[model samples]
Target: MGKFFYARVSSKDQNLARQIEAFKKMGAADEQIVCDKESGKNFNRENYKALKSALGLRAGDVLIVKELDRFGRNKQEILKELEYWKKREIRVMVIDIPTTMIDIPKGQEWIMEMINNILIEVLSSIAEQERDKIRQRQREGIDCMPVKNGKKVSTKTGRPVGRPEIKKPNNWSENYEKWVKGEITAKKAMENCKLKRSSFYKLVNEE
Candidate 1:
């Protein structure tokens, strides 16, 4: 049976060194480990997909991860992936969960399965909840930013923050008038104004 490891981080800037080192300590070769520097919010990651492909994993193989949360933050999706591997006769081992890393007696394997189910349910829910909390915090932070003259301002320096407002193009009036009168297509007007669809519509609404 082959052994493989999967590691993930939430963003490109986040480090994967710790997870890689842990996998190395477990005797996984560099080629046996797949890493993704992307969010765990879903299972659409590139490296993760490659790891789950027919060429990478097979029945009787073992898939190892540093933690269950690293596998995914979506509870239902995480459970679905687990079920997929289970049906294929592949073992998924999470290092942080001691029980999952242990071997059970052949005849009593059901006991371990029951315990694993309970732990997975609880931990996956917690991971999903944590992801929701993080999103809420980000929204709150944006809402709490001070606004000055209709623009968001930094709390420290009272300076305008975030994206600068898009200004109307010099030829906007002429192009927009033509577009409104059906003399020119919206796409043509946008091209003349050098603005994208969203920006063109935003300018139109403002006018």
Candidate 2:
């Protein structure tokens, strides 16, 4: 019924203007644009959760993104959502990486769809792997930087500050591992944690 656009920037210092411009150029209305000033490596963001909950998605609704990575760094999560939206007859368009859209008749060969789905899985897997690699390299680089009396100098803030902890549900880690091992149904997990089903999956499927 409506067109939705999502844009993300990893931190407060980064601006969403470029992505907003790109989405507007794609004909997305101001009201339809959703911006998340957070990391895509984690999907449990307030803005992302809001968009999913709104589910303004119907048969012909479209989801537009500036790039595929903007969707998320986690590949399996991306592929899962893509399949979910497709089943709902929602179209997702990534401007930077097109050709992700599949055009299939009402009744067609499932094999073709399966093959395309596999490609999405593979590409997303690669994206996740690359993200991990980048994180590892960043950690190494930070470690190699000169330290002053056991404290790393801050180039931006000019004051030594510890990396901020990402707030997560208290039992998220334990619950997620347990759910993955089939210790509990997703619904039971959510009930135990007082979270939603979608939140449970988002935590469990985290990279």
Candidate 3:
């Protein structure tokens, strides 16, 4: 029976060092290691498909993964693959789920199978549920984007949330212009402009 190991990461930028190290620790040869740097949300993994086809699995062959999530994040998909492999008489060994190891004696295969089934059900359910929760949180966050770049966001109105546009004095510019053109004294400009000293200076400098 052939021993093969699988590893995965959700994205290309994600570090694969840890998973590769785990495979090495398990004595998986360089060629025995197959990795997919893609989402575990579905089975649309290229290297994963290649691994299956390349191995041409048969009875007694084993497929190993560092963890259950590395195998899949969807409950239905993970369960489906598990049953598929089982039917083909190929054992799936997950490092974290010790019960899945194929090293057990032939006589104890049934017991290990039962235990692995139970673990798979529980772990896969939790994985899928956690993934759903994370997606929900992400949707809610991006939907509203509570705060962005230190400014509260308003996706609906396309404005800063809770902050209204500043309304400058109606004739501040006219008065400032008059002051600049020497038509009005600084004191008169300040009186007519209806702006604080800092604001008047700020607007003047801005122009």
Candidate 4:
């Protein structure tokens, strides 16, 4: 019964003017605009969490975001949220990607739905990469140019100062061969397996 606009910036120092203007152009009232100066890695953001927590988000409520990344970076998480919103009959519109807005052309709902899903998948992956960049800058606490191959180089020393790569744990071949082949990182594999540091290595050594 209501329209909601979500705008996010990774930090307070960033400007929200453009997003605010975009929301107004989309006919969102000033009060309907929800701003979050936080990461899009998850939904733990203050304003975003409050919006989700609020009651009465019934069917037909429209949630608008400036960009797909503004929604979140994780592909699985984004798709899951989209499915949940769809089931509740909520309309999710990503302004930059018109295909994402399914409220148009009821006659071509099927086609639009297909295109929308593809866009969601593609955009979410790109967003995740962008989120990594944001986290990189955040960890450094300053805006530094990222060098070749996603390495953060030192401004003064002119040398790579990236995170130290972890060696593949034992049983990485048996338990998570994907990590060994470099399809995924050891940390990611461990997270996917839900293994604690001790337990994961214990299994590794056991093998």
lDDT of 4 by residue, 1-207 (tens): 798899998788999999989999878898899999997777778887776675535688888999998888887889888898899898898999987664577688888888888888988999998878877876765345557567767777777775454455554565566766788876787887776676667666654
lDDT of 2 by residue, 145-180 (tens): 666667776666556546532345787778767777
Model 2, position 42: C-alpha lDDT score: 66
**lDDT order of candidates, top first:** 1, 3, 4, 2
On a 0 to 1 TM-score scale, where does candidate 4 land against the true structure? Answer: 0.63
| Residue range 82-162, candidate 1, lDDT tens digits | 999999999999999999999878899899999999999999999999999999997787789987799777787888877
CA deviation > 4 Å runs, candidate 2: 101-119, 155-158, 161-207
Which number leads on TM-score? 1
Each prediction's RMSD to truth: 3.3, 11.3, 16.4, 11.4
Model 3 Cα lDDT, one tens digit per residue, 82-187: 8888898888889998767657897887898788889989999998988899889967766666676777686676567654534468887788788989999877
Model 3 worst lDDT run, 10 consecutive residues: 158-167
**Preferred candidate (lDDT higher): 1 or 4:** 1
lDDT of 4 at 48: 77
Which of candidates 2 and 3 is the stronger one according to lDDT? 3
When 1 and 4 are scored with TM-score, the better candidate is: 1
lDDT for position 15 in model 1: 93
Candidate 4 collision pairs? none
